[model samples]
Target: MKYAVIRFPGSNCDWDMYYVLRDQLKVEPIFVDYRETNLPIDVVAVIVPGGFSYGDYLRSGAIARFAPIMEDIKKFAEAGNPVLGVCNGFQILTEAHLLPGGLRKNQHLEFICQQQDLFVQNNQTTFSNQFKPGEKVMMPVAHGDGNYYCDDVTLQQLRTHNQIVLTYSKNPNGSVADIAGIVNEQGNVMGMMPHPERASELVLGGTDGLRLFQSVVTRQLQK
Candidate 1:
């Protein structure tokens, strides 16, 4: 299976995610430029890395949604291919309608950059397969527009489907119900505000984030 990581003009974490998949996880990484109209035919999965795309001008991810490649990304996701969106990538997913809900400014209206404790909510999906439900893990998050919002009814549906993947242990961003990450109904698409790639190296802090990338490779092997 081939792994493709999207690269937008202002993407800064693209290389970090690329290294995580290539050097750390030992997977061949394909960087897909945002200008490209299509994903490689063999691409079996994708990672939309974090960064202030288009400088977050018209609002985070607002302009990126119109990129020609976004349409293909959505179609690829609908075909059940694994899709992981991190930070600004999460914003893009919401903007592109691949994931439900929107990410607004942090409750404090400040850019928060620090390690956050997260509790695993659901480990049944491809993205969380390596984790145990309710387990605590620490990952770094850096963003201003990280608060997640959605209607109460949609939130209830998310709960009913067990779609919530992770919850902030300390509610750092004031997201509803303290949600930190979530998966689509099909479980192939997931969006999280944390920078898992930043924590993939033990020397930096912990390798807890490595499993997330491994989860993708493991799931591919299962198929």
Candidate 2:
């Protein structure tokens, strides 16, 4: 299956995600420029990789949310196809209202970049099925706006629906409820502050993140 990697101006991690999916995961990677209005016909999954889009002008992803490609992504996601957004991509997903909640500046008001410990809160979802339930994994998080926040009612709804998929073992960004990643209510779309593409290879210090991509492949193969 083909995976579409959306590339906006200033997207540094787009190549990283492309490499992992194309080389390591053994899938076709189609780079979709932000200005494009359509995804490739064979694309089965969409990936919005992390980076400073539009130079992070108004807000992290505020401007990029209006990009033409996002409308196609929104429709793809609504069709129950898997969509994974990392860091700035996560911010974009929320800004576009594809995912609930929003990411704000880190509590300490500084950019953080490091290996982070994360617990898989739910492994049954499309993006995390390769992981064991409650598994602890390490992924790199690099961002200034990674603190996730939602109101009480939304938090409770996330809890009630098991939409919370990953949480920091030791909260680093002061995210509400220690949430590091979450899926949508339908569970096909996921957004996270961590950069799984950076951690997907052993040469990159760990292979924990490879399973996330593998999970998506496995899910597709089963269908």
Candidate 3:
């Protein structure tokens, strides 16, 4: 199967994501430029990797959200295809309204980069089926604006629908309810602050993130 990795002007981790999908997952990964208006027809999944897109101008993902390819992405997502967004990609998803809530400056107003432990709150979704509920996995988080915020009602809705998928073992960026990752109501799209690609190899410290990619591949194969 094929996956699309969207590359923006300042996307530094696109290759990292490509490595995970192409080498580790043994899947074809197509790099879709932000300027492109469509994804390859054969792609079964889309990955919006982490980076400082558009130099993070006007806010983390405010500018990148308007990239030409996002319209097609939105449509692809609406059709029940899987889309995974990490860090800056997560911010872009929220900006595009593909997901709810916004990422704000870290509570301490400083950039943070470290290994973080996250609890799997819901493993029934496509992005996390390899994990057991309440499992703790370690992944690296590097961001200056990773604090997630949403209104009270939204939080309640998220809880009600089991949309909150991951929570920090110890609140890292002061994200509400310790949210480290979340899925959309339809459960096909997921957004998270941690860099799973960075943790997918044993040399990188652990392989906790590998299962996430495996889960996606398994889901596709089953279909």
Candidate 4:
């Protein structure tokens, strides 16, 4: 299974994500330049790793969403391939319209970095299939614009559809409904504020994030 990690100017976690795939997961992940026009056809999955893309110039992920590679990434996602967006990557997915809602500055307007416990809300999605519903997983999160917001009806719709994949055990960013992650309608795409890649290895403190990647591999192989 081929994976592509999109890299933008200020994307700092690409290497961490790469190493997680290559060394830990033993899957080769291509580093695709955000400026690249065409994507390799064999790319079956794409991860929009975290980092302050474009230094969060105009808004986190607002500018990076327009990168040349996004068109191909959109095409890949539309074709039912799994697309996992982490942290700023989650913001980009929202900006790209792959996911609903937008991430806003923390209600407290401060950058928060700590280990958070996330409750798995839905396991049907390819991203969270390895987790049982209501399971709590620990992962590190570092961001300022991790507050998720949407209209009341939209939030209701998401809950009704089981679109919410994860929720923070405690309100960390004051996100509406405590949403920490959500998947698209098709379930092929997911956007989350927590850094799963950062928690993939035991050295990182916990392996709660490993199941996310493993879930993708498991589902892909089943197909």
Candidate 5:
């Protein structure tokens, strides 16, 4: 299936995501600029790649969410189509209210760049269906505001509903409950603070991230 990788001016990982989909996964990825509001009809998935949009001014994704395309992204996600947001993309999703809670500054208040181990918490979602829950995989994370936080009530609901998709095997950014990723209740839209595209190739040190993309593409074909 075709995917659209949204591109804001500051987006750095757009090409990485594109290369993974096109060269590695053999799927077409259309690079849609931030000003565009309509998605290609052939696009079965959307990707908001990692980047410091607007120089991460005001806050990460606070400015990026105002891009003309985000409203459409939200609508596309609400229609139960797959949308994967990585790093700053995760910040955008939270800013746009596409997902719950917020990503605060790392508890240590520093930008962290490191490879981390994450356990699949829920494999039922389109993003992680290829793996079994509790499986550990390595992915790279780079962000200053990767610490996920929410009120106790919302946290309880997320846990009770099994919405948490991935968790740090060992907390790295001080994220709440070691959450590395999560999906909306509908299970279509997924957001993670880690850069899966960066880990999709063995040359990049690991190929574990590829399973997330393959899971969604395979599931769509099954439908």
Candidate 6:
């Protein structure tokens, strides 16, 4: 399956995601510039990889949300095309209004980088289809504004809609209810702080993240 990896000026993980797709998964990722308003129609999935977009100036992903490519990205996601955003990419999705809630500074006010565990909260979505509900997987996380927050009513709505995708097994970032990742209402868009691409290879770390990407490609082939 064809995957698109978007690159903004300060996006550092674009190449890492590309390598994971091309070298590890043997799928060539389409490199998309942040300014490109058009997207490749044939691409099956789009991934907004991590890094400090716009140098995380005002807020993480605050400025990058307005990048030209985001228009098409939003369109594709709205049409139910699978979209995954990691780290600052997650922040971007929230800022772009593609996903619910928002990210804020860690309660402790520090950047965190460590291997973390995430509970598979919603396995029905294409992004987490391979994992069993309640299962936990190890993935690395690096970020400052990883704290997720939403009001009580919205949190209830999210739970009712099964929008919570992954939850921190250990409450690493003080995210509300330990929410580490979430999916859109349609289950087409997902945003998470952990770096799944970083865990796709056993040599690099582990293969827990392989299934997330593989599931998208596999579903596209079935279609």
Clash count of each predicted structure: 0, 0, 0, 0, 0, 0
Off by over 4 Å in 3: none
Give the whole-model CA lDDT for all candidates, comma-separated: 0.91, 0.95, 0.95, 0.92, 0.91, 0.91
The model with the greater TM-score, 1 or 6, is 1
After superposition, the stretches of candidate 5 with alpha carbons farther than 4 Å from their true spots are: none
lDDT (tens digit, per residue) of candidate 3 on 1-223: 8899999989999999999998999999999999999898998999999999999999999999999999999999999999999999999999999999999999999999999999999999999999999999999999999999999999999999999999999887989999989999999999999999999999999999999999999999999
Cα RMSDs, all models: 0.7, 0.6, 0.5, 0.8, 0.8, 1.0
Q: Ten consecutive residues with minimal summed lDDT in candidate 4?
A: 19-28
Summing lDDT over every window of 10 consecutive residues in candidate 2, give the lowest-scoring window: 194-203
Tens digit per residue, CA lDDT, model 6, 1-223: 6799999989999998998899877887989999899899888899999999999999999999999999999889888898999999999999999998999999899999999998998888888888899998999999999999999988998999999989998887789999999998898899999999889988868988888887777767777
lDDT of 5 by residue, 129-154 (tens): 89987899999999999999988999
Tell me the deviation in Å of residue 217 in model 1.
Answer: 1.0
What is the model-wide C-alpha lDDT for candidate 6? 0.91
Off by over 4 Å in 4: none
State the local distance difference test value for candidate 4. 0.92
Model 2 agreement with the true structure over 1-223: per-residue lDDT tens digits: 8999999988999999999998999999989999999888899999999999999998999999999999999999999999999999999999999999999999999999999999999999999999999999999999999999999999999999999999999999999999999999999999999998998989999999999999999999999
| Model 6: lowest-lDDT 10 consecutive positions | 214-223
Error of 3 at 199 (Å): 0.6
Candidate 2: how many backbone clashes? 0
| lDDT of each residue in 55-165, candidate 1, tens digit only | 999899999989988989999999999999999999999999888999999999999999999999998899888988789999999999999999998899899999999
TM-score comparison, 5 vs 6, better candidate: 5
Candidate 4 lDDT over 114-171, as tens digits, reads 9999999999889988999899999999999999999988898898888999999998
